[model samples]
Target: MTICQNVYFKLKKYVPDDPPEMGGLFGGRNGVITSVAFDQGVSRSMCSYTPDVNRMNAVIEKWNLKGMEFLGIFHTHFLGVRTLSEADKKYIKQILNAMPEYIVQLYFPIMVLPERDLIPYVAISQKPDVLIQKEELIIL
Candidate 1:
């Protein structure tokens, strides 16, 4: 998965040494991430993030108008959690199940800070299951 420089920079700001973690959504034309929607009203906790539906929808609407697809979610994990937790996989499975059959996969990228290490994964929607696999993140 490839992301624009601006989005990469923005993701770096999600360092959790402060308290709660941060999260957002990102997508673009083709397969490169050129647009990102940061949820200003995101419900953040010590180890969880729930997006504001209204805010997320608003951004999706704008992106749709501009012909950009909603690829997937981007979240931050506390330092040392370099991989997706079981909870994360469960939530992603739910998302894939809820999505229309036409959509085959969604990108789920995690940023682990303060190292700001980005780990990318794509969730493949396979009817009864969603398979999460590692993806190489390329910054452009």
Candidate 2:
């Protein structure tokens, strides 16, 4: 069997003193992984706060040239909600509508109880008509 390489996030910068909230948000721009860190207080329920389109576009542009694309999005799940929700699907549709050529990736950070470690589950979608492809987990 052939296996594909999974993409991971790299935080460009961050501010300290953020609360310990439940959620995750990250994005890749122009083929480079950036901004994978999230403000813990921004999560609500089983979903992380969605960034505004205009704001997101601005961030993508800051890291990429005009007409460049967003590669993917990543987020965390709290309270054991690891699967994508209806709202997440809607956001995926909106992202595809905004950048049809870009692949959108989603991540769920699973916190294994008792062990106290976080494991990430990743999914990637290339187009609206295609099914989301999940990458196998590999520990590094």
Q: Which candidate number would show the highest lDDT if scored against the true structure?
A: 1
Please report the TM-score between candidate 2 and the true structure.
0.52
Q: Report the C-alpha lDDT of model 2 over 7-75, residue by residue, as the tens digit.
A: 232221222213232333444444443344343433344344454556556656664664544445554
Instruction: State the TM-score for model 1.
Output: 0.87
Candidate 2 contains a number of clashing pairs equal to: 0
- Clash pairs, model 1 backbone: none
lDDT, candidate 2, equals: 0.44
Local accuracy by lDDT, each model: 0.78, 0.44
TM-score of every candidate relative to the true structure:
0.87, 0.52
- Deviating ranges (above 4 Å) for candidate 2: 1-48, 66-69, 100-130, 137-140
Candidate 1, after superposition: displacement of residue 115 in Å? Answer: 0.5
Q: What is the alpha-carbon lDDT for the whole of candidate 1? A: 0.78
lDDT tens digits, residues 1-140, model 1? 88998888877764445547667888798878987776533554467766566776678788889999888888777755888888788878887787667778989887776677889999998779788999988999
| Model 2 weakest lDDT span, ten residues long | 1-10
